[model samples]
Target: MTAAVRDIWRHPIKAHGRERLAQVDLTVGAALPWDRVWAVAHEAARFDDAAPAWAHCRNFTRAAGSPSLMAIEAEVDEASGRIRLTHPDRPEISIDPADPADAARFIAWAGPITNPDRPQPARLVRAPDQAMTDTDFPSISLINLATHAAVAAEVGQELSPLRWRGNLLLEGLAPWAEMDWPGKRLQIGSAELEVVEPIVRCMATTANPVTGERDADTLGALKRGWGHQICGVYAVVTQAGTIRAGDPIEVRP
Candidate 1:
């Protein structure tokens, strides 16, 4: 098996924005350091707090769902236990995950995505152990940029690589062609994460990462030719360690 570690990212807050990293420390069965560690939940969130379970959907609200959030890019300052959300057009934002005052600021940052009709305020919650991200995986994501390009060729649109929101983006395969990689084990960085699920393409893809415009039929290009509207695979960590961009990947039987 042969593979290469491409890109690494950690989203301190889901759907808000992602922070790229030179390297990340991964623990077996744990998400990369702090990737998708928390997310905002509306007071109207329809789930049982007594028995909370992770939602099995890549449900992110960005400019498509909330335009204001598009301007905020989160950065993790580990030394301060703070995540700073910066924007080109807005005032600099700094929040401490452990402080309630910062939580209020987060609520203010979210307007369109907030459901005011509900009694509880929207708060950022951490991704819990055993929580799967749209599938059964603690922490691992991969996408083949080649696949994105192939899809773009067919659709005649230039899609940015950031649109996929993947932690591992590769550069040498056809569009939506990672389907062939399922059931294989990938050696990324110093860890081995098994490719275990087929990423289900959804409406999120239609939402532009930059302009926040809605582009329908993002999946149309895939269904027309690709066996699946998937450009990547989800992985489960079989081993734990640090991985960085440019690390070689290997497929193991």
Candidate 2:
């Protein structure tokens, strides 16, 4: 098979917004650079900055809990440590997450968009070292286009890859081929990644990225058609190098 990277994406803040990228450098034993570097801690969260660690997704404002979060777009300026957030229902705002005052401003801006029934957003929390990914270990998410096509067919509608929220989108792989990739290694350009595990489908996939509406029964479709709720795979970087869209991907035994 002639698999190649079709797109690349990074989320500077977890479950908030996605940023498209043409190319990115992968480093050994780390999440994507600047990806999920910050997360919004909700009122019920118990994350401690003194000894920061990966906490459950419930501690942060996420798309699964608040579909409205998917409607937002973010632009992060790593040099300035400033993030610009734009939402359809509200005016665009720029805030420096490093500043306590600015973090408070972000919390205020996000309050209404997130679920009011749930705990309110309190502050923005920065990961002490690596980005705050869903998995316990640092990894990148990969999705096969053919697998997405199969899911869309099962749902009887066109689906957006954004709902999957994967870091790398690969084309030319057979449907569900990625399910067998765990324990295998893949080479993209000069970087090598070892597939770690399959990513289970979550309620977040049901939310439309553009409208932020819960329109699709993705989990139901996956269960009914695939007999499982997985759509993507997580891989840990084993060799460090730059990878770009359209780069040829090779699977290694």
Candidate 3:
């Protein structure tokens, strides 16, 4: 069977918003370009700007804690280092996350949507030479559309794949086929990647991207139908190449 790329996505700021791409150039030993490259540290976070380093997800504001964040969509301008964010409940705003001048404005814009009980957003920080992914290591998440369909069917609702926050959405594969792919290599388009492990799901998957509301019980569906709370696999790029939508994914021996 030939699995093909259905969509490509990146979240420039961790758990803040997502951007879809038609094509991207992959680099060896790197996560998807600009994916989770920055994160918003909360007021109670321990991250030090002077000495930025890889910190745990708990240090940032995320969808799992604030479902409203899921409703955000992002558009990034790589050349200008600016990001434009839009949400259903708020006016669109654009800013350069690296600039200190725009930091306060960003926080105020997102403040209303965030959970009042959770630690409020304090600042935006990026560690040099690191992507703020959930995993300490740089990796890309590959999701099987078939498996997503299965989960949606089990839940008796149409779930958006965005809930999973995966980098690559693949189709034409059997449901849950990725579970057996750890330690295997896959060639997609011209890029090669090695499957690392299954992604253990979190509560973030229950939120609806359109409304940013926890309307679905994805965890319950996964546990009841599959006995595990995993929907995708993490992969590390092994070969540098450009990949595009419609690219065929081939299992490499």
Per-candidate TM-score against the hidden true structure = 0.84, 0.97, 0.98
RMSD of each: 3.4, 1.0, 0.9
lDDT of candidate 1 over 1-253, digit per residue (tens): 2345567766677667678888887777776666766666655565444665665433334333453344356789888778887655456778885587887887676654332343433665554464425554575778887777777777777886666677888755445556766788777778878787777676556656665455535678778866567756787788887788888877776
Better of 1 and 2 by TM-score: 2
Regions of candidate 3 where Cα sits further than 4 Å from its true position: none
Predicted structure 1: lDDT: 0.66
Tens-digit per-residue lDDT, 111-164, candidate 2: 889988878888889778777898888889999999999999999899998899
In model 1, which range of ten residues has the least summed lDDT?
Answer: 112-121
Decide which is better by lDDT, 1 or 3: 3
**CA displacement after TM-score superposition, residue 23 of candidate 2 (Å):** 0.2
1-253, model 3: which lDDT tens digit per residue? 5799999999998998999999999999889999999899999999988899989999999999999999999999999999999999999999999888887788899999999999999888888987999988889999999999999999998899999999999999999999999999999988999999999998889999999999999999999998989899999999999999999999875
Worst 10 residues of 3 by lDDT: 98-107
Give candidate 3's whole-model lDDT. 0.93
